[model samples]
Target chain A: MFNLIRRDFIIQKRQLVMYVLLILFFVLLGRQDPAFIFLLASIIIPVNTIAYDEKPETNILMNSLPYTRNEIIASRFLGTIVFIILATGVTSVLMYVFNRPFTTTDIAISSSLALFLLSLYLPMSYIIKPGYSAPTALISFLVLAGIVPPIVSYLGERLTSVTDFLLNLPVPIFYTSALLLGIVFYGTSWGVTTFIYRRKAF
Target chain B: MENVVEFNNVTKRFKDFSVKNIDLQIQRGFVHGFIGANGAGKSTTIKMMMNLLQPDAGEVKVFGMDYKTHEKAIKERIGFVYDANVFFENLNLKDIKRIVAPAYKHWDNTLFTQYVEQFELPLNKSIKNFSKGMQMKASLAIALSHHAELIIMDEPTAGLDPIFRRELLGVLQELMLDGNRTIFFSTHITTDLNRIADYIAFINRGQLVFNDSIHDITENYALVKGRTEFLDRDTEKAFVHINRLSTGFEALTENVSSVKRTFGDSVVVEHATLEDIMFHLKGGLQHV
Candidate 1:
């Protein structure tokens, strides 16, 4: 199972430099939110790894190996967490070295959002046809980005009592709850992907 | 004889095609060649053996164990090669080996290095740059390095130059030097089987026609030729299918003796090659 996870790194060895450069590009150029930059850094590697894995040939190769379908999916979910931590750590160091300002809150929010985005993307990648999932994910992310804020704000304005109760919660507890919710979604996505993958025919 | 793989009443259905009720057994310590035309469910059967595609009905077993309970154990003992390159195309052979070698518990690096040298494969060159033959050699090298007891390949010799095809056959023949190894490979090229295959399993149009020894297949099936007048409703029972030309008629028969007995020296009977058998059988069995 570790071998399966390590496969992503080996496959993308040449692109490792590019990944670093991509993060640096964002860090150095755009005046984007530090949290958003961190989110991009966390997402680049795992999502790119999926792009390679979504191919039929890759699936055939992985399935033909001694690993079970459960083990394969486990590696992907576990590997996503591993890369999220590693990429976030690396980005933090880069931010520190550049003397940029980022708080623990920034790390918390970005990592949680990373988990949420990936939880949704991983299962959808398996469900969608190969060569199209990346675009589908991009389009859906854009659509959600455009529409979700308005919906959430509208609901917040309409449901004052619920919004007041949530807003009254302590900051640490709120962030912790957000992180916990991300974990729940991640776990459910893992189960869903494994189910879909087990029934899939090569 | 110990059976390395078995399929019992296995059926897989697709909207447009299906592999119907197949019962096949592959013995240990022999080379079994699966021969069929394009879209004949050869790959489907091979995929079921690998557990890539589960059967809609019935069971498939390997090494006397079912896949549901022993998927990893079964796969660990069996190595697979598909019709196309399944390795990451952009990665070189060495990196690919690094990724694949650790998956098996008994991967032999020395044996892998030997095959790499023997096949003249470049370690640093990306697989995308390799020729079809080289890509096949790469797959074979990995499949062999694991010390797998059963090596299952689907269309390994398709789209290769004749020389490389012969070379691949020679490599497979050498692998058979180990008395415990068994090879099951599918191919449309019937001639390759004549060189090394000890048993032949012929499938046509999603149905298994026969899975028998080369000696039995050759002994049972033959080509009979004579004037068209020799073929009658009663006499036609001897032949599986018949082709009538303006000059004469040539037919394939599973019973060589019946053909001789019915014609009484009027028709010439010749040993049918694998091609002849496949060609005649592909025309659909005649019911007389």
Candidate 2:
């Protein structure tokens, strides 16, 4: 499985250099948006691979090889995580070198959030085709921002006393909670995608 | 029969076209020529047999194991190729080796080198720049270099020039020297099948029209060219396909002996070549 992920990652090696330029370009804006860069590329890079898969009509070739469809789909999921880890690692070094505003808490928070976003998107890709995944992703992104952000902000602002209490807890507790949430969403998404993929005739 | 591949009442549906019902069997140790016209559900059935697509209705088995249950193990021993260029456009042949080499633990780098040399494929050039024949060779090399028992190919030599097509078929013929090796190659090229296939299966519009050994088909099936009146209704029953010609009527059938007995002197019992057979099988259409 890791071999599959590694193969895909090697194919997408160009994206790495392209992403670094974007991160370095953004750094000149006077604020550390490595976290944002990390989040943005997490979705875009994987989708690009999926798009390339569609472009060359390579899925038929991949399907013929001695791998399960589930294994192939699972590789996409696992590959995204590997990319996220690499992106986060690169961004962390940049942040440390430039003495940026992204502290450890921000990195942890953004990383988990990116994983949740990836989980939500992974299944959409298989449910829909990759060619349409971009527009669908954009529409869904708007819907999420419309609904989730307000609800989250309301719970954070209106329930300030409780929120502040939890926020002020030892950072490890917050980190662990965030980590578990990310894992649950990822596992759930994997289950949903695998189910859909197995049942898909093509 | 120890068949390498079998399908039982399989059905697959696409929005515009669907394979209605399929029952197929290919025995181990002989090359089975899967002959079908374009869009005739040949690739679909092959895909199902290999578990590239799941059957909507029935079962597919390879090497005595259910395709669904033993997909990974089955895949490990089977190699497949499509007419389309499967490698990444940017990568050269060398890069493909680096990536796909690990997928099969039994993959032989030495054998790969031999195929490359035999096919005269370039080692350093990117595949995007390759001619259609070169691309086909590269894909075939990858498929053959893996230590696989069965090789499944879809339209492998459909569009290549006669020279390249023969070259490709020559390699397959050489591979068949090892009697343990088997192949199920699909193509519309009847001449190619005539040259190499031990058995031939003709599929038309998702239905298996005929499945038998190549020799049996060529000898048993006859194209009787005569008048409609020369052959009565009884004589026409065994004809799989018949059409009225200006001279008379031409019919295709497998029971050449019965046809001969019925109309001994009046009808010409021409031994149908694979081309003549597939022509009638595909509604007797004229094809290159």
Candidate that scores best on DockQ: 1
Per-residue lDDT tens digits for candidate 1, residues B1-288, read 999999999999999999999999999999999998899899999999999999999999999999999988998999888879999999999999999999999899999999999999999999999999899999999999999999999999989999999989988988899999999999988889998999999999899999999999989999998999877899999999998888999899998887888898898999999999988989934421
lDDT of 2 by residue, A26-106 (tens): 655645355565566456677676666554246666666777888988888888887777777777776667666676666
User: What docking tier does model 2 reach?
Assistant: medium
State TM-scores per candidate: 0.97, 0.92
Q: Candidate 2: lDDT of B201?
A: 86
> Which 10 consecutive residues of model 2 chain A have the lowest summed lDDT?
A29-38
Tens digit of per-residue lDDT, candidate 2, span B123-151: 88888999988999999999999878899
TM-score of chain A of each: 0.92, 0.84
Clashing pairs in 1: none
Overall local distance difference test of candidate 1:
0.92
Q: Model 1, residue A199: what's the lDDT?
A: 94
